[model samples]
Target: MPLLRSNTADKFIVDRRKPHRNSDVARAVRRSRDRLSQRHGTPVFDRELLKLHAHAIVGSAATIPLLVLIITAAGLLGGMAGDIVVWAFLTMTCYAGLTWVAHRVRKADASRLNTISTKRNLLAGHFISGLGWVYFATLGCVNCQVEQFPIIKAIVLLLAMAATALITSSLRGALLATFALPVAAYAYIGINSWAPIELVMTGLLALSLPFFSYVASHFNRSSVMLLSFRSEKDALIAELETAKSMSDEARRRAEEANMAKSRFLASMSHELRTPLNAILGFSEVMSNEVLGPMQNPTYRDYARDVHDSGQHLLDLINEILDLSRIEAGRYQLNEEPVRLLHIVEECCHLMELKAHNKDLRIIQEFEPELPRLFADERALRQVTLNLLSNAVKFTSTGGEIRVRVGWTAGGGQYVSIKDNGPGIPPDEIPVVLSAFGQGSIAIKSAEQGTGLGLPIVQGLIHMHGGEFELHSKLREGTEAIAIFPASRVMEVLPALPTRKVAAGGRRR
Candidate 1:
């Protein structure tokens, strides 16, 4: 039943809302909407506007006690605080309702946020709070002759208005409506007062309205920019995560394909080698006339050719198998202590005949008393032989090939094979190093090769914790160097002295 999918497709939507974790109350209060608007622009997101409304509601509620103290001190109630009490009660109730709405919004799913009804509720709360402040501003102590009483009342009203503006400044429309009503009421009351000092105070209050508006605008802008930056940052992080996932998947697939190729090669090599061995054996017998002499000389030559061709094919297969084993991590090295001088001399002696047949000279330079190397002797011999063979194959008749063995500057050992042949071009160095890749010169010359020689050598040297480098230039020469690390270089121990038994039969 679970496997039987529904006919209707399920809609998937990405949620981009970020969690709000900043709870530094002092930072929030200091980042008043007035200051933000001057530095930036009004918040573009509706959620930001809702947040500002909530802050304003809370700020107004906090100022209620202060309002009561000022009212009582001014003696504006004439011993009848009933009117002010009722106004305060209504203001508190409006704030409590706004607080509940804010809490609901904060708890609501992101999908339901920024709805039309939510904005309407927030604006209504702001309007009611504004009206409460306006009433306080208009009903000040008119009968009090004491100068400080009216001043204190005005100060309290101004403070409340400033707090409302700062809190709601994230939303331009909300802030304007909240502060404009109270400021206008105060201006009206001041202008109507017959006292000269009242007129002066009224003028000052009227002048401050524009400054308050400017501050509110700046605060709104700053909040908008901050919110926009956070949104952009979240988007970039999501994109990076997606890219990383794609890259990991691609790498995994590539590794699987490589393993499959290695398995196929291993299977085919075994199958092909069996038939190749029979071909080489029969051709060699016919060429050598093991049973009877060939009736014609041409028949003998043709048989010899067949044997040579088969031998070449067998060598190619062996190279391929070696490279595949190395790549598949199946090649095991039989490690032992090998003298560098001995291995190089043996490889050179084996390739000497081939060089002489081509009329080329083999030059040898050995660093005396070189330390023995801890490595696979067979692998080292193959690496040396491959380099020497390549040099002999590439060099023209009468060219000189130099082979050198020495201790490296860092107390390690190295082998260098240099040939005065038509050298490899600079661009083809990587091609020469890669498997089955032959240089252009080798391809065009009489002697061509399956490009596996250098790759095998490089792989073997790497297994021994050594480095192989091929340096060449067009028409100049080519040099191949393999350097073994110091860890693989064996240290010589001090010789023990032989003890002599002198006059063993004597007691002295």
Candidate 2:
């Protein structure tokens, strides 16, 4: 079935292009698959049209012979019964041949059938049958006294033309081939007799040929359009199938690559960590002279540098792995009820010494008696530490970092870490939030970072059905807010009323 249809597309236009060069062999083998229109007419459309004409003509076969029999009966009212019978027999025989050809063509394989030859034979059959009408028009009716007999003959002839026009319309020139001769004979007979009724009948017949042809042209256009639409629909379906297969292939390759990445990281995690742990341990022991006093002071400095470098490398590795796991959806949250205030307070206390070294002050503010939140406690601690570290790193001497945990406008819980540091530019906020993306301030500052801190925080908050927002202004401060949704904000139940039961335990 066609996927599209229209009612206002009854225009007659010819396709004058040559045969398509692409897929010629395929179209020849299975004409049904042909989607191209060509000068010689599309093979599928031509075959379909021929099949249509054949089937229509075959379907109405019984009626054609009846017309001939009626004409024979009419002509019999005249004095030439024997001649009329012979003419009717010849006409019926011609029609029988046309029907047989149509039936054979219809039953045959459309892909192998010769459309050109079949059309020629059908046209020839129609023309031969018209000769019977010419002979009947000339037959004399001496014994008959019926007036307006010419009109009756004209009506019958017109009816036949109309029926033929509808059936053979798809086969170009078939209608004209059949009726042209009969119309000419009528004109000739009328001119010789010079009778009024005969002349009118002849004129009517002449005019109807073109009118019927015009109407038949519309039918032909409709058939071709239907075929064209079908071809386009098939082509679109083929393209969609091709695109879907390509998408599937791409997704399969991506899945395979992700799996390979996961395996590589999983193995490298143990292998790399083993060495980093050793480097940090030995470097710490050597720098601190845990085993013995160092002979040279320079050796102690070298050990400290090695330890610092190793620690930095370790931090980078951990950040990269965390970001990867979060992005790959492998970081499962150990969800439990944890107080947000305790986590932030502990992180502040931990960073207190580092903040004091830089002459920075860390202040903690909590909404009193805040409810426990459903989240991963370790992740919350990491998020708090990362924010406080950034605050200390970016703040100038004696700058203050304010940590606040409070309720959001939507009845949710939010932890906001605000630092009065050399604030980041508003436009660079996105750069700061993306994985491994640092801003100009961080690049210029002495402090080092993996730049995955904000992204990891965002990911953790999002996994808990929450939102993360970062607001900043130049020369002012930057505040990073992680909002947990109302769903995760554990509701506090009201204490049950003490029952003052006097007798029974079942008190209301």
Question: In the order shown, what is each candidate's alpha-carbon RMSD?
Answer: 9.6, 12.2
Candidate 1 deviant stretches above 4 angstroms? 1-96, 135-169, 194-214, 222-224, 500-508
User: Which number leads on lDDT?
Assistant: 2
lDDT of 1 at 78: 57
lDDT of 1 by residue, 1-508 (tens): 3687665433332222422232343343344332333323222356655664565555455565566556554454454355566666665665566567766665665445654777777767667666766776666544545554546546765676576567667656665566577777777777776666767666666666666777877887776777666655655554455555556656655665666677777778878989989989999999999999999999999999999999999999889889988987898999999898999999999998999999999999998998788899999999999999999999889999999999889889999999998899899999999998988898998878999999999999999899999999888889999999999998898765444234543536
Cα lDDT of model 1 overall?
0.75
lDDT of each: 0.75, 0.82
Report how far residue 220 has shifted in candidate 1, in Å: 3.8
Best model per TM-score: 1
How displaced is residue 329 in candidate 1, in Å? 1.8
How does each model score on TM-score? 0.78, 0.70
What's the lDDT for residue 40 in model 2?
A: 29
Residue 217's lDDT in candidate 2: 89
Candidate 2 local distance difference test against the native: 0.82
Query: What are the runs in model 2 whose C-alpha is more than 4 Å off?
Result: 1-115, 121-169, 181-194, 218-230, 352-366, 387-404, 417-448, 469-480, 496-508
